[model samples]
Target: MRRRDVDTAVRHAALTFGAAIALMPLLWMVSASFMAPGEASTLPLRALPRRPTLEHYATLFTRLDLARHFLNSVVVTLAATLGSLLVTSLAGYGFAKLRFRGRDAMFRALALALVVPGQVGMLPLFLLLRELGLVNSYLGAMLPFFGSVYAIFLIRQYALSVPDDLLDAARIDGAGELRIFATIVLPLIKPILVTLAAYTFMAAWNDFLWPLIILSDSAKYTLPVALASLVGEHVQDTELMMAGAVVTVLPALGVFLAIQRHYVRGIMAGSVKG
Candidate 1:
């Protein structure tokens, strides 16, 4: 091959190797999840199951009650995602479209909030949740995600590009702010909403630390926390842990893959407007 052709071929080969290396752990997790209880940890370290079985999954659902944990994850993730969308979109649109004194200053202050670690507020947050009787509740798990500065920034940048004339025309026709938001602003911002939804959903789904702190009841534990529980309980069961990891990760992975095109477009669109 010519030097140019050789370089191109080498780059493709390097990329393929990098892809395989990145995917190896996930591949092993799936493979190990299918192996019999003791097979994956055996001498020689089998990469694939000799006889794949569903018993690990069966055990997780039936005996361990991971179904409940899965449901908890779904509930918290959906609630957080929808709540984040509603709140962040409204805040973003308002900040972008509406005029008020010190609005820019107020937004800058909120942006500065991103630098503060969430753990810094844990004590007060816990105390507040206790007072509101929201501890150990799904709503408690979701409340923190109801709005986010990054989400607002993204939507604000996108909303800035929306035509002022359209909103003014709607107002001239006597449409209320809520009505315009519902009918006009939302449709114009659907791509960014989907992007935000996917992000919020995945973050909520994978969350562990906050859920562990807020939820005292075993029944309220999200999947990641539950899987951590499984680690302590089934310390020797590699297959079971892998199964739990798969269960925890699959939905978030699926959602991201489903709307990745919209997510990418919204991101690019936001970048251009920004």
Candidate 2:
């Protein structure tokens, strides 16, 4: 082959191999989830289940109350994502567009605070929640994330592109600040908003440590916490665990896939501006 053709062939081969390697674990998880109980660990490791069954999934819903934890995960993720988006977007827009004393300094301080690890404040936050009687509640699990430093930064970066003349015109027309934000700023920033929503939803859905610490009751456990507890009690049930993994991962994957175009655009916009 010519040199250019050979190079193209090599690159294509490398990409295909890398893709296969990356997908192997996910394929195994899905396969094992369909295997009969104890079939996954037989003398010979089977790449595919000999007799595919939905028994593990049935067990998860019936015995483990997976449905309740699934609902809990959905509720907490949606609430945290929407709440953070609204709060961060409004704050970001105000900082970026509205002139106020000390605004730049405050925004700079908030940006700097992002460097501090969230875990550093866990103990104090937990104690405060306990004092407020918010522990063991979904609100407690989601409270810390209602205002995210990163979300504010992302929204601010996007909101900076909005024209000051638009706001000035709206004000001159007797539009209130909140009304302009609702009708003008929000609609203009829809792509970044969707991107932020997807990101926050994924983070909240996959969060393990905070929810585990705050939610004392099993009934309120999110998917990751519930899956951990399930694994502890049913270590040998590989099929069941795989099924649970599938359930936990699918929603976040779906959400990301659905909004991936906007997410990519938002990231590119922020990077170019920054």
TM-score of each: 0.94, 0.96
Off by over 4 Å in 1: 265-274
Where's the lowest-lDDT run of ten residues in candidate 2? 265-274
Report the error of model 1 at residue 17, Å.
Answer: 1.2
Error of 1 at 72 (Å): 0.4
Candidate 1 is scored at a TM of 0.94
Ten-residue region with minimum lDDT total, candidate 1 = 265-274
Estimate the lDDT of model 2. 0.91
Q: List the residue pairs that clash in candidate 2.
A: none
90-189: candidate 1 lDDT, tens digit per residue: 9999999988899999998988887787879988999999999999999999999986888898899889999999999999999999999999999999
lDDT of 2 by residue, 1-274 (tens): 8999999999999999999999999999999999999998898899999989999899999988899999999999989988999899999899999999999999999998777989899999999999999999999999888989888988898899999999999999999999999999999988889888877877899999999999999999999999999999999888999999998878787878888887677667657845
Q: For model 1, what is the alpha-carbon lDDT of residue 2? A: 95
Best by TM-score: 2
